[model samples]
Target: MTATTLDAVTPAGAAARRPVSGTVHSWDLSTGVDGPGSRFVTFLSGCPLQCLYCQNPDTLRMRNGRRVAADEIVAEAAKYRRFIRAAGGGATISGGEPLLQPVFAGELFHRFKHELGYHTALDTSGYLGARATDALLRDVDLVLLDIKSWDRDTYRKVTGRSLEPTLDFARRLADLGKEVWVRFVLVPGLTDDPANIERVAAFAASLGNVSRVDVLPFHKLGEAKWAALGMDFALRDTPSPTPREVAEAREIFASQGLTAV
Candidate 1:
């Protein structure tokens, strides 16, 4: 099991340490929070969407995480630069939704880029507004944007939000020449529909600067977290996506001239 720790400090101490202001719900200062390649990742607090498959349900509540300053986060991230450089990886600011805390993320990204010179990435669901998108994109080097589904109805059913904003955000990123890796969770009988996959592939092909497409096979890793939070697990009986299903989705994207990772 993956273990997590929480650190709480006084506002004054936090302020004196970092120039940026905001609350950090939780943070993982370890290597490989997302995958291989040693890197530091900060799990920012708060989110606007209620994705049914989200594993970090505790981060959904805005008030539940500890309050932390931006500089403090930067300071913590700086310590891992050597590891990040050696592994060809850097710091990634993830969330409940990083865009929800634009100011904090912006400040952190600016410091990492200009001050520390560490590569930066944003792992988001891409549901932020135009203004927020512009601010967050200024310093982000790589974007791991999640596109839940191409159909508005399916997106609404899965994430409890509209699909237009996310699509618009993706387009905006492409226009800015930002490197984006579009990700989709391949959920059986939900997002794995061949028709939907074709539509999504077509849409992604329309965007420029999308270097990669990732087809993530859905798993029930977060079900226990949901149960612990006393929240209903919608995909309780949903089996993990099969290898054949994943291969099919990959093939769909490959045929669209996009490299599927």
Candidate 2:
């Protein structure tokens, strides 16, 4: 999508200011899942990985999204400020992989935090964490980092990407003292290996900055999306983790001294 320039006044005379724009799939309001309370969540389009259980296959490509400027998104968020504030909530910029358009993500967070005086969170996989500049991170109050797997081989199999980058990003965030909430999807037979779960738990606990760990049970909510997109639903037969299995996984993280939910 092409960038649009906005008119601005300079000390010398009228000037042009180009705000960062990005391909946004859509946005929504949600509570208890996205962040602290209620949140105006913007879902940007485009991603590098092809996970087997991706729920939003329709958001996998930039072409499927509408081009929107950071300002436009910020304006829309302002409309929800009152309600969100009343709920002790804020704003979140989620993806298909937000860091894929780091500049646009940064601009949105900067405005959400500074301009709107709201708490801001970035929902990302950390695969493109290197793209997130310190300036961009400065405005982010929280990061919801998805760590798919602790096993290198399993990670690549799940995301079609190496696990090293995510690990590196986690360490970087730790060093930066950034508050992070780790999200782990519990897929039976795939990610439920107790050993793998232990490794993840150990790593997250060591981070020191990890405030919460969300053990998300796997589901087929996206199977229909895959069918609609004409893509094979590889995990169609894979059942959701049983309640017992989910409890066991959460216990693993809790054993690590992390507040797992």
Candidate 3:
């Protein structure tokens, strides 16, 4: 992708423009889905995971997104800073996996906090390298971390990856005292097993920084996206998690003393 140019007058009043850097699939400066507060959401590009139920399948291809400067994103987010502040909310950087583009995510959050005074959150899969972790967490206020599954074999089958790194990332986040909300998609046959739910609850309970757990009921919302891209939908025959399933999963977490939202 071609680098996008971002023009900005320097604080010294000099005429200058710099190339803002980062791969961004798209950005919705304001979205209500991310957290308690209204948010200015930046959907970054690229992800390593290939979850069968991924809703944004198009985001999995790193090359498909546009390259934009971090400054450009900050500019757009700045426009809504007041609205974010008024609503007790802030900016949330989500992605194909925001951690995949550490430089951009870090710079965006840094600018948001230091430059614009907006609260910052990262919605991520936490599959980033150690260096990326250091960068991405620098100014982040909250994290919406997706814990794919508890059982290693089941995790591998669902995401084409192991669960160790994701768990390690969560532990590190907790060590840093970062506020996190652990999100799990309750896939009927995959994630709703009694044993798996209990395991997940135990894992989450061990994390001090995990403030909440969100049991997102799996749906066919992404089937069309998969069809549009001509990729076979892996969970096509699978039905959505029933209300009772969600409640059971919620109870599993609640048993561990963690609120499931």
Identify the candidate with maximal lDDT. Answer: 2
The clash tally of candidate 2 reads 0
Give the Å error, residue 56, model 2: 0.7
Backbone clashes in model 3 = 3
Model 2: per-residue Cα lDDT over 32-100, one tens digit each:
898899999999888898999899988888777898877789899999988999999999989798888
TM-score of each: 0.89, 0.94, 0.90
Between 2 and 3, whose lDDT is larger? 2
Candidate 1: how many backbone clashes? Answer: 3
Q: State the C-alpha lDDT per candidate.
A: 0.79, 0.88, 0.81
Candidate 3 at residue 117, lDDT? 90
RMSD list, candidates in order: 5.4, 3.7, 4.2
Which is better, 1 or 3, measured by TM-score? Answer: 3
| Candidate 1, superposed: residue stretches over 4 Å from native | 1-18, 29-36, 133-135
Report, for all candidates in order, the number of backbone clashes.
3, 0, 3
lDDT tens digits, residue span 1-261, model 1:
011112222222255653556656677755643533666788877777898788788888766677677778878888877877888777788878887767667777777778888778888988874545465577788888899999889999999999998898888888889888888899987888899999999999899787889899899988888989889999998998879889989999999999997
Sequence-dependent TM-score of model 3 = 0.90
Off by over 4 Å in 3: 2-19, 29-32
Candidate 2 local lDDT, residue 140: 91
TM-score of 2: 0.94
Scored against the true structure, residue 41 in model 2 reaches a CA lDDT of 98
Question: Model 2 scores what on Cα lDDT?
Answer: 0.88
